[model samples]
Target: MARTRPTKRQLEGLLVTALYGATWWGILSSRTPFNWVLTVASGITAECVRHSSGRDRLDCLGDAFGAIGGISGDVETGIRPYTNGIAQTKTQIISHALKQLPMGESLQQRFLDRQGVNTDWFEGFEKRCAVLVGESKDGKTFLLKWRLQRFIEQHPDGHEYYIGDIDYGRCHEGDTPNTWFDSPVGQAVFTTADDIAAKVRAIAQDIRDGHDAAVPTLIILDELVDTMEDMDRDQFEQFMRDLKTIKNRGLKAGNITFVLGLHSTTVGETGIPQWLLRGVETIWLYRAGQERANFLHLNGKNIDECPKQLARLPRSFNGLRPCIVYSDKKLSVKAIPTLDFGNIEVKYSTVELSAIQQWEQDHWTPEKELTVLQKMREREASGKTPYSNRDIMPIIGIRQNQCVRSNEVYEHAKSLILALWESSKKSEG
Candidate 1:
């Protein structure tokens, strides 16, 4: 004869004990490595047999057996290996999935298939804020840039990008304040945090109202606080407060992710309020000093084994090679090489030299062409390059001083213009 099943109360009681008590039920359900069908089936069977197994009533032997089977399957499939003290609750699992889903369709689909999270599930999700403490000029910018590119490439759907770098130069001129990111006009604008916060609020509004037309926004602030030497404590506090306000209010409106970058010491050194620190979820520490060591904690533990590679980083490598640093979770120090600007891809049409003749053909009338030639002649007589910063800055909003700071910037800009000019001449031919 087939065995009889237990009542719902008996089953619940057994399952609860098997899962190490009610507090752990959420983790058991969500983090179980066993296939969902198998997990549910096994759980049901354990419930039916728990009381009849003749095991200690408090032991819940049947449910324990089921949990063992589920955990075995989970391990084979490479699920969470160790629970440690951290709560692997269902809520946390779902929260982590959503945060990382912006990376690609595969991830999004994985989360969608779970069928556990409700439509309003993410409403209460709040991850811990992080403090990325790193040494000065230790490829922090490059790492931040890489993560950003990865996020953008993975999420083809519209995402907002806000970058704040304190090192504002003459090259960044004539940019508008708080523009939507999808258009050329918006892309043309170089922004500060103040500009980004306002834009984030607007995008968030569109998302909250179920305005299907709105796109997600990714705001990246490079060197988050500007002019460190000039900004005072109160002023810095206010700036951070404004950003916190924007973040708190914007979450309801749309998908807004902020990737803020700053030297590890800026906030502490400048006497900025620590209240801003509470708003960050994950702190990606690049290279930090001893004083700021306490701020960086990994997997809920203080990182005692800091990487020595960060000790002495050279700013400029052999004209070609990029400076690199390691910061992977497993290795504690994953190598991140510099990007090769020469090999970087450009999707939109760039101003190429070959296009010069096309420009002359399409836009420059014979009279205009002749007039330009005359002007070039006059410039040659004056010992000036007809193509100087004066001629280009107005069009690109890049200043001469900023471009000239490093030979790399100057050469790149110069090469583009030269390429365009040559291309135009060839087209004219």
Candidate 2:
């Protein structure tokens, strides 16, 4: 009869016995190095056999070792291992094993290498408004702030402004209290939505009348949807309209550019006007869906490609993430990087409340009040009910005042003038 091949179990048993015998002999001969070599060889041999036999290497090793008792015994003393028989911790072993694995470039490094844009792209960023949309927890805010920080570093002389929902809380990683607002190098940073709207109006006016400073202005509006939600419907719509107007005017004047961060869902949701969405010249989408793609005016072909690209993204938020970038030239998938600003301390100009109040008091003169009143009356007579502060501020020549806080000053002046007008009307009646 032909000799039958040994079964897998029988072969595994024979290999285990041979390894055990070799290990015991090595220990008895005081050859510690040989014992270690034998141990490694036994593991490798078992792994190979298991691979050939269609079994898990670890499972086969466990079975073989279990049948022969563990290999951790003192072979020289011929004593089985004791000490509660606890197995070696896998955590330490795995960690050490991982250290031996080949390392690759970091996600951020890989992304920057493949960005395909030159330094000129970042330098010319002030020419257009970029809107970044992403799902919640996809690090859209982080990436937005990173771009702002990069811009500030690249263009140190550029005036920057941050408009966001973060009033006093920590918004960035490792940010302490007031860090986000305190760090940005800007003419002024507005946290409240109302204040941001007023500042935008003032900036637009500055650009419109050729009064804006020669330096480029970088405006970062983080969580635009959140800011809009804080305002009433009418106020939100007007805010979007004002943003559109600012974008158009600023682009022509070459004075201001914006980086707006909003949720992917917010773009398609009601109450967010389409004109605001259309104002974006460059789009950065992070893990977006069809709704957001449609909102970006992406056709079906591009929309179908979005999910395919997003699916290949790694789930870690540790570094740069994949984004679908749509610009005036082309639409493509790209990686956006973030920065770690935890250790960098930035200096901010502190505005004393008393100084602000005093400045307003100084600028709010009787003559200015009379000028504002005359303009409002003119607009009222022309059938414009509830004249905007924007229409009234410039006519009062607030731009000529050389006030650093021109927006706040104009607002205070407008409120005082409106109150004065109401008082005069009541007295006349």
Candidate 3:
């Protein structure tokens, strides 16, 4: 087959002109200039039409002219807009990718008996909030705080936390209005029910809009008694109802949980309404010493055995013996052991505490104190003792004793030393 090529004159002339015009358009529009080889190679171009006042006809040679014109328009109108869109899209993709990544480590497997109970009790209950009411100093706050923390940690990508508390000492000085918007915990605020509905919506909107991360947020109403105490029964009922509304709305839209803590005198008083009780799923009762029975009653248990089972809990039970009751149609009781805060050398377990009580024939006596002191003096006399008074005090659980502050452990140790000295002197005589 025969083929024809453009003459060198035509190639060098029209193409050269087209290339120059295209290069001019590219340089004017670009942040970085066009390549030199492309400019030289594409120089030839068409000038097929004349601008005249007449009906236009398609030029037989308009393709080359149109191609040259298209290059200039694309440089001006298309490149920058397309590039910006791509950059924004990449940012969104990266953000979403980061969200899917898991936290560095999974939590250790510790059995939370009470949480398990609450899980079982609230199995079928929907549209509910738990009302924990009991004697002060019970582990209500401890358990509630722990569970809330665990829930948030588990659902890291659910919604951002929007915690609102009162303006107590905990709220910090210089905390201003809308200060929550600046909080890394995610737009938290300290406010009352007066404008809570609006503030909650605003915080929730920010989360939904993707401006904030969609992590499951906890709204803790600390000392709820302070706010709801003065309110009449109807008013209290209305407040509880409003919370239920927030719960339903917030949960459906994203992950939002509300936790409130109060004393029994407040939530159990005449100001509260009965209808509001239906909204709560789990009720935790915390009581210290002799109030365990009262706590049981609030959780829906009846006291059966009288004085025998009503014995006072040990003084060391301040942080011990975490028991739980589940709120189903009725409350079920479970007795769990206490946690021992001790060194490995003197680690006391619930079983060990009971054993020690049985061995002493009375529980946690100071009589063993005198005996232990005698042994320490013997060790010191023989120069076999390596540990000091500092080492000995904690072993007996008397170092940080709030009731008996040990400023001079040596004074206490001196008495034990004197007892041994007197006994040794008498034996020699």
lDDT by residue for model 3 over 1-429, one digit each (tens)?
A: 011233333233324334444655444444533465454334323232222212121221122222322233244344644453432232123123223333201110011221222233432222234555434434445444444444544554443444444533343223233222234322344455433433444444334434332444556565566666544454455456556655555565455557665554223442444444434444434232223333333433333321112121111121233233334544443332333222212111111223322322221223344446566667777887633555454444445442243434434444544564576558769
Q: Between candidates 1 and 2, which one is better according to lDDT?
A: 2
Q: Cα deviation of 33 in candidate 1 (Å)? A: 61
- The Cα error of candidate 1 at residue 283, in Å, is 4.1
What's each prediction's TM-score? 0.34, 0.52, 0.36
Candidate 2 residue lDDT tens string, 51-119: 666654233332332222222212212432333222222112222322333331232234334433222
Which portions of model 3 show Cα errors greater than 4 Å? 1-128, 170-186, 191-215, 230-238, 247-253, 265-270, 288-320, 335-429
Alpha-carbon RMSD, each predicted model: 21.6, 15.1, 31.0
The superposed Cα distance between candidate 1 and the true structure at residue 110, in angstroms, equals 34
The TM-score between candidate 1 and the true structure equals 0.34
lDDT per prediction?
A: 0.39, 0.51, 0.39
* Candidate 2: worst-modelled 10 consecutive residues by lDDT: 85-94
* Residue 373 accuracy (lDDT) in model 3: 56
TM-score result, candidate 3: 0.36
